[model samples]
Target: MKKFTYENITHAKELNIYLEQGNRVLGALGYTDHSGKHTAKVAMTAGKLLKKLGYDDHTVELARIAGYMHDLGNSINRASHAQTGALMAFQFLRSWGAPLEDIAIIISAIGQHDESNGTAVDPVSAALILADKSDVRRSRVRNTVPETFDKHDRVNYAALSSTLHVDVQKRIITLEVELDEGICFLMDYFEIFLQRLLMYKRAAEVLGLRFKMKANGSKIS
Candidate 1:
């Protein structure tokens, strides 16, 4: 079996069509951007997170692949998109001649990346969770009208900047978001993203690291 690299999957033009369609589906559903930009961040962050923790190289690549492909199930439906995307990824990766062992890791990571019904089940899974959940930014907001922004949109739009920092020596991972309180309060962020925060804590635990969140340069949780 040919070894599948992150470059192989990420640069494949055909795979992008699936990602674009999934992103379009999210856009139509009034959700924040799930497009290439978001996936690219997820992919980079996942790989970086694992590498910083000193995971093996192939595992890091698998984490990247899972992150890049994680949201594709949104193309079908938002509900249970994690599981759907995993199945779809399995078929595509298999067709690409990826080994079953590697395919298993990628699919499992994709399946468990969503916070709705997924938890960190492995190193790659933990990396994917931390990477996917911590991605909050104003750029992700797609609503044309500020007056019509929903809770999710408001929270995202309020975010001025976001950075995920991993401190290997301390075994801690922190997600720092700078927000514009004028658009949404810190309370609003917690109200909408509490679940994601809780998931982040658990995911970091799986990686033997502590998870912390800072909003507006202050630790809130």
Candidate 2:
């Protein structure tokens, strides 16, 4: 049997189509960029986190795959996208002859990434949750019209830069964001992202790490 890798999943035509369509759907609804850029960022972030913690290569790769495919179900609908994406990924991975155990881990991580109905079930799932929630930046905001910008747009646009730092020695995962206060207030950001940050905290706890958040150089979590 061939070993399935992140490259295989990333280049899959059907999955790529779904990701593009999902991004389009989100764009039409005035949401942030949920396309290849976002998925790739999540994949890299999850893999890096696991790698820093000394996880085996295969486990880190599984986390990467889960992150890449987590938002594919948004192509169908926003509600319950996690569940739908998990089912879709299972079928696709099974068809690719991936091991059942690997499939289970990937799908579980995908399904548990959303803050609405998600938890840190395992290391992969926890990593996925942290990575997905940490992706906030100006580039994510697609709505260019400041006058018509919604809360999500405002918060994302206000973020001039963002970075996720994992310190293996300290067992700390920190999300540092440089916010443009002229664009949006700090309170506005917390109003929209507090729950997501809380989820990140729980996910970090699952990995025996401390999660911290800093906006404009101030620690908020």
Candidate 3:
């Protein structure tokens, strides 16, 4: 078993600052789950899923890195933040002496992470899509106090819990959300997330798997 390590010094400290600053900015804008914990979870999940699918270590690491830094563009603005994030990541990685090809992959992945602004340009993009979409849940909003809970947050907050499981042998990727109907119903949740879920299905197709969503013990898809 080989461990992955990058020679970049800035990744250790500067990435921390980016994550912190992103959290502060999103908190101000009433968005939840753009913080360290969220990004870390996404990174780990993306890497593990790719690794389980038998991708090379470099690919998995790229997926992890892309997942971690995907939301940094939100620091500047919500719209087209993915493109801004890609440029930011490209400059930082280049400064730290990361290879240009790898930097390109990372930047492309970051730039296309948003469903509205993104497309699956590579396997990394597919992995990132799975990781990002799997993060919808109630616990994500447990700490942040939004001024007005919109459909996005309300459906997410209504989830009592959620789990994303990738079954390698079965070629199955399941997103299960335990819901509390007092806050929002399944319809409301689907109304907000259905499109993203479709994107997740396409992402899963790229990974040769099925994307299944189970809400309150019922299979919705």
Worst 10 residues of 2 by lDDT: 1-10
Better of 1 and 3 by TM-score: 1
Residue lDDT tens for model 2, 1-221:
15589988898898899989989998887789998989999999999999999999999999999999999899999999999999999989998899999999999999988889888999999999988888888888887789999888999998888888888889998989898999899999889988888898899999999998888898887
TM-score per prediction, in order, is 0.96, 0.97, 0.89
Model 2 misplaced stretches (Cα beyond 4 Å): 1-3
Candidate 3 per-residue lDDT over residues 177-216, each given as its tens digit: 8888988888898888777887888888888889888989
Deviation from native of the Cα of residue 166 in model 3, angstroms: 2.4
RMSD versus native structure for model 2:
1.3
Candidate rank order under lDDT: 2, 1, 3
Please list the C-alpha lDDT of all candidates, in the order they appear.
Answer: 0.89, 0.90, 0.80
Per-candidate RMSD, Å: 1.3, 1.3, 3.2
Model 1: lDDT to the true structure: 0.89
- What TM-score would candidate 3 get against the native? 0.89
